[model samples]
Target: MIRGVRGATTINQNTEKEIIQRTEELLLKMIDANAIVAEDVAQVLISVTNDITACFPAKALRNLDGWDYVPVMCTKEIAVPDSLPSCIRVMMTVNTEVAQKDVNHIYLYAAQSLRPDLSKS
Candidate 1:
């Protein structure tokens, strides 16, 4: 079945290094928590808050081994009033034997506030 894993994190700043680092941290946690392998990933969709324009989160994934073949895209999130700032979110589509209910989603840092119901915190 094609399952989806969701994750989100916040960066302290909008710099390229901060964005990339935070994105990498979020992706690694999501991938590890869900046992996601490169071959199983169909695509990754990343969205960042409008305030974060320094770099694309997808660029960070390119540095991962075997991620070069995976399709990744990034876009700006819809600007909503009172929304979390400097946030990066990801929805990864993957072919997995795991049931939908078994999938583990990750939310880190201040982004945890965005999904209190699903968060492990």
Candidate 2:
């Protein structure tokens, strides 16, 4: 079976270091929560808010030791009026035996307010 794990996090600044750090943190939490391995990941789709332009979040995943071959992409989030800023969101598709309801969705930092019900805070 295939399932999608969703996660979101916020960075204090738009620097490449900040983007990579927060994105790596969120991806690690998602992997831990779902027991996901690099081989099982189908693709990772990352989107950052308009305010974030320093770098692509996918850079973090590629830098992971075993994730060199994992397919990942990064894009800009829709600029919805009055929406959260400096936010990075990810949807990771993976092949897994876990039931959809059992999958964990993570939201951290200021992004926690974006999905209070699913926030890991």
Candidate 3:
């Protein structure tokens, strides 16, 4: 079955280290939570808020996971007022036997503040 597994998190600061750290952590959790092996993943799309630019979150995933064949794209999220800055979000499509409800999306760092309600769900 093809399904989407979502995960998101944010950097508390506007530095490169914070961006890479948070993104790598979130991606790992998302994959682990759904028991998604790299071979099972179809594609990954990363959406980040406007405040961040130095590094792409997808690069962090590649360096960490060694998934060179899995396609990953990055885009800028719509800029909104009073929203979380330095936030990186991911939507992953995978071929999995797991149900949609069985998927556990991860939220960490400042991104936790963006969607506390979703996390609780």
Candidate 4:
């Protein structure tokens, strides 16, 4: 079976260093929580708020030890009025035996408010 693991995180700045670091941190937590393997990931779709323009968040995934071949795409999040800023969201589709209800979604920093029901913190 295939399932989607969702996660989000926020950054204080739009620098490449900040974006890459936070994105990598979120993805690592998601992988650990879900027990996901690089080979099982079908694709990763990352969306960042319009305020973030330093670089693609997908760059973080590619830097992972075994994720160089994983498919990753990055885009801009929709500009909703009064929405969260400097946010990066990720939807990772993977081949897993885990049931949908068992999947874990991670939200970090200020993004936790975006999904209080799903956020572990």
Choose the strongest candidate by TM-score.
4
Clash statistics: count for each candidate = 0, 0, 0, 0
Question: For model 4, which pairs clash?
Answer: none
Where is model 1 more than 4 Å wrong at Cα?
none
Q: Decide which is better by TM-score, 2 or 3.
A: 2
**lDDT string, candidate 4, 9-114, tens digits:** 9999989999999999999999999999999999999999999999989999988899988989999888999999999999999999998999999999999999
Residue 67, candidate 3: alpha-carbon lDDT: 85
| Ranking of all candidate structures by their lDDT, best first | 4, 2, 1, 3
**What overall lDDT goes with each candidate model?**
0.93, 0.93, 0.82, 0.95
Off by over 4 Å in 4: none
For candidate 3, report its TM-score: 0.89
TM for every model, in the order presented, reads 0.97, 0.97, 0.89, 0.98
lDDT tens digits by residue: candidate 2, 1-121: 9999999999998899999999999999999999999999999999999999998989999878899999899988889999999999999999999999889999999988988987757
Which number leads on lDDT?
4
- Determine the backbone clash count of candidate 3: 0
| Per-model root-mean-square deviation over C-alphas | 0.8, 0.8, 1.8, 0.6
Residues 13-80, model 3: lDDT tens digits: 76778788888888888877788888888899999999888787777877755588999999999999
Error of 1 at 41 (Å): 0.7
